[model samples]
Target chain A: MSTDHLDGNAAAGALREIFTTDLTAATGTCASCGNVATVAQAVLYTNAPGLVGRCPGCEAVLFRLVRGPGRAWLDLRGVTCLEFALPDPS
Target chain B: MATVSRGFFGRRRSGDPDLPPGQYLVTDFPVLSAGPTPRLRTEDWEFTITTETGEKHAWDWAALMALPAQTPTVDLHCVTKWSKLGTSWRGVSLDTLFEDVESAAEYALVHSYGGYTTNLPLQDLLDGQAWIAYEFEGEPLEPEHGGPARLLVPHLYLWKSAKWVRGIQLLHDDEPGFWETAGYHNYGDPWREQRYWGD
Candidate 1:
């Protein structure tokens, strides 16, 4: 559903920047690898607001990585580390 | 009025206690399994139909369309519980696609982007209902929806409905795809209620 269409290359670049910093701060593991599981890439799209980056280790892609309307909710798809960061932990 | 047959995510049923609803929809278009229109123009788009005898019949998109078109109304059930009914689609019947291919007795493999793949008995692929769709709802299919073309098998779960489909490869055995190997049902039969892991 990602209609916030940044140029594909640009989106990819933005994801790279987000992965390097924000993700590492939030989760120590790589987004792609799930091994080191550290943040490797991140991109914020107007459409897929909470969407995150792919896994750094395996290059496995995870669509719509973020959770929340204005960045408050976190639907981590049951991801443990991510859920812990939520203000209203379920 | 013809209504699409559908069910909800969860519903109360007498005697059965509870039956999970599975939703889906059908299209009234030529749902062809299309390959990527390479970013480059003038690039050759090649496809092949393999047979049990190990024979391969190859063709370009133009040549393939020239063969014939048959329309079938089918019930498309996605793994996500979305079902569409009486969707009309026109395409070369799998039987006709295999005409002269000489391997009707073998299995068929469908390959696509994102490492998605699935297998069907040659019998299933040859079903007159199967198609390599080119249009959806009377319009040229869009890219985000796997436009230009896509494979539409109304009989199976929609994930088996590989987007950005390319070619048909005849195989002697079944092979699980990215989803299937990751625990999706191999056959993906919706009516049989096959969907995710252990189904």
Candidate 2:
């Protein structure tokens, strides 16, 4: 199948269900490719069992999500680590 | 069979027996895809079904159009919790395609033009349960919605109804598809709430 994919921002809404901050702006490294980039740069594929985010460098899956009536599942096996920012103290 | 939509303005009436568990009603058909949509021209498109022994049954646009088509009205339950009921579709039945095909295979791996694959029990595709739908609600299906033709198997979760369908490879053993391998339920049955690996 010749497929197209959107960037991680396309999945920000669905991800908001779990994250308190902008996970899209957080830097993450792909477990397979070691490419470190903000989640927004990740290629996202919507329209399946859930939203999938892949690495731009290797096309390896970085995250997977599946939602139900009252529950949601997010898999980040392809992501090695994620770095999020905290608000500055006054 | 009354129409129900939980729109931005109103709430849905709980306990609607028609919908499977964990599903909500949607008046609008939501577009979801694992990748970008494939634009397939009918003239260049062909469908194939390969038996376990490598016997190929192929049909091009013209050959497919010549077959007797059926209109099916069915409900669609998505793993994302959206369910659309009483949708109409026009296409050739899988029964006609598999009528004379010889295969002892119990499973089928459906391939799509976009490199997407979804597998299911072969029996789920026959006996009027499936179709290669070319039209939806009296209109030619558009590319994003799996135009040209898409597998229409309303009995299972919509994911099993592969979009941008290309062919089927009959297999003796069960095969996990794109989503299935990506932590999705191997056999996605919406009614059973099988949305993930264990559920």
Candidate 2 chain B superposition, TM-score = 0.94
Candidate 1 lDDT over residue span A19-48, tens digit each? 454444465343444544433343222221
TM-score of chain A of 1: 0.30
In candidate 2 the C-alpha lDDT for residue B162 amounts to 89
Per-residue lDDT tens digits for candidate 1, residues B1-199, read 1122344323323443122254433333222221222231112555566655667787677876787876666666655444455566665666776667765355677876433467766677655757777676666657655555667777777667666666777767776654555445678777677665455
| Per-model RMSD to reference | 13.0, 9.3
Give the proportion of true interface contacts each model preserves, from 0 to 1. Answer: 0.00, 0.43
For each candidate, give the TM-score of chain B.
0.74, 0.94
Per-model TM-score versus the true fold: 0.59, 0.75
Candidate 2 at B49: error in angstroms?
0.2
- Candidate 2 yields a Cα-based lDDT of 0.86
**Model 1 segments more than 4 A misplaced:** A1-90, B1-21, B24-44, B51-54
Model 2 - which docking category? incorrect
Error of 2 at B74 (Å): 0.6
